[model samples]
Target: MRSGTDVAYDDVNELIATATRLMQKDAAPDTLTPDDVRKIGEELDIPARYVDQALEALARRREEQAREAQVQERHARLRRVRLRRSAWVGAAVLGLLAVSGLVVRNGLTSTLSDVARQRAQVRNVVERRESLRARQDTLTPGLSRDAELSGADNRVAIEQRRYDERAADYNASAASFPTGWVVRLTGLPHVLPLSSEVSTW
Candidate 1:
């Protein structure tokens, strides 16, 4: 809103100050046409050629600003697309890695379980042989034959052989490539191919 056009000002400076403050809030930000530029130049004693050069420079600046905005928009669109695809691809890769990790973990667990079982069998056979030998030793060899003791010795040997084979397999797996990493991560027990300690009865 304007103070009435008919209002009197104390001086030109006062009028200019009021107009400046009003323009700060009330300007429409419209661009000047060629006619407006010429009229302004004529009033301000500016040359027509200078006005033409100013218009040409303004046009070039506007073109540059428009191009910069387009480039920025294109980059933004590319980033959005990459982010969207990365979400899907990342999820799929993670799913595959999870499945693979589980498989390796289960495999190691199963092999170690077998090694533990076979170790128990070997121990049981050795204990049984020792007990039979003790019983046979208590009885005079002349009275009872070596049949039970022989059988116990054979069983102990067979079970020991089986346990050795199972331990060997476990050791091989633990030393293998990706499964080795899995074993390390899962804290799986390490098994040697065979034990050197001997039990004799």
Candidate 2:
């Protein structure tokens, strides 16, 4: 017959949930160190081999995530370079056209000003989202995982979605026809240009 240590968990979430329930029943400490973790595993009838396997899986996941981040950063840089080149070339053409009165500078200038305003709005939304995310992280260990944490998470998601929408609106205006070239020329960020345009705070 299988022992209690033979507990089968399909995923990390299941393992955490099982462990948490057991710990709560045992009246374990709120905080736990590495040794505490191992001890708890023993008390919970969790196999040492499973713990090692979980650690290995976690390490591999982190490494994969790091590599993914590097790739995103590289792609973002490449996009910026390509955009810079195009924007500068367009700016030169615009300057010549403006000088010869072929293109009305006032109309384009007004559009660029509007794009800058949209960019400012995106930044404000990003600030609020980040602040909420920080609080969520702080409360992860002991906070009620139900309504309060979910509410905070929902708020963050909403802000992030709002940021994405506003950024898309800005990028659409900035990337269309002559406005994109002008916006970049005026030193405005693309703000989620490509779907994979990764950015860090």
Give the Cα error of residue 137 in candidate 1, in Å: 1.9
Q: Residue 180, candidate 2: how far off, in angstroms? A: 26
Candidate 2: misplaced stretches above 4 Å? 1-33, 96-201
For model 2, residues 136-165, the per-residue Cα lDDT tens digits are 676656456456556655664565555566
Q: Report the Cα lDDT for residue 115, model 2.
A: 47
Error of 2 at 164 (Å): 63
Question: What tens digits encode model 1's per-residue C-alpha lDDT throughout 62-172?
Answer: 999999999999999999999999999999998987788789789878877887798788888888888788777778676344877778889988888888888888888
Worst 10 residues of 1 by lDDT: 192-201
Q: Estimate each model's TM-score.
A: 0.69, 0.32
The model with the greatest TM-score is: 1
Prediction 1 TM-score vs. true: 0.69
Best by lDDT: 1
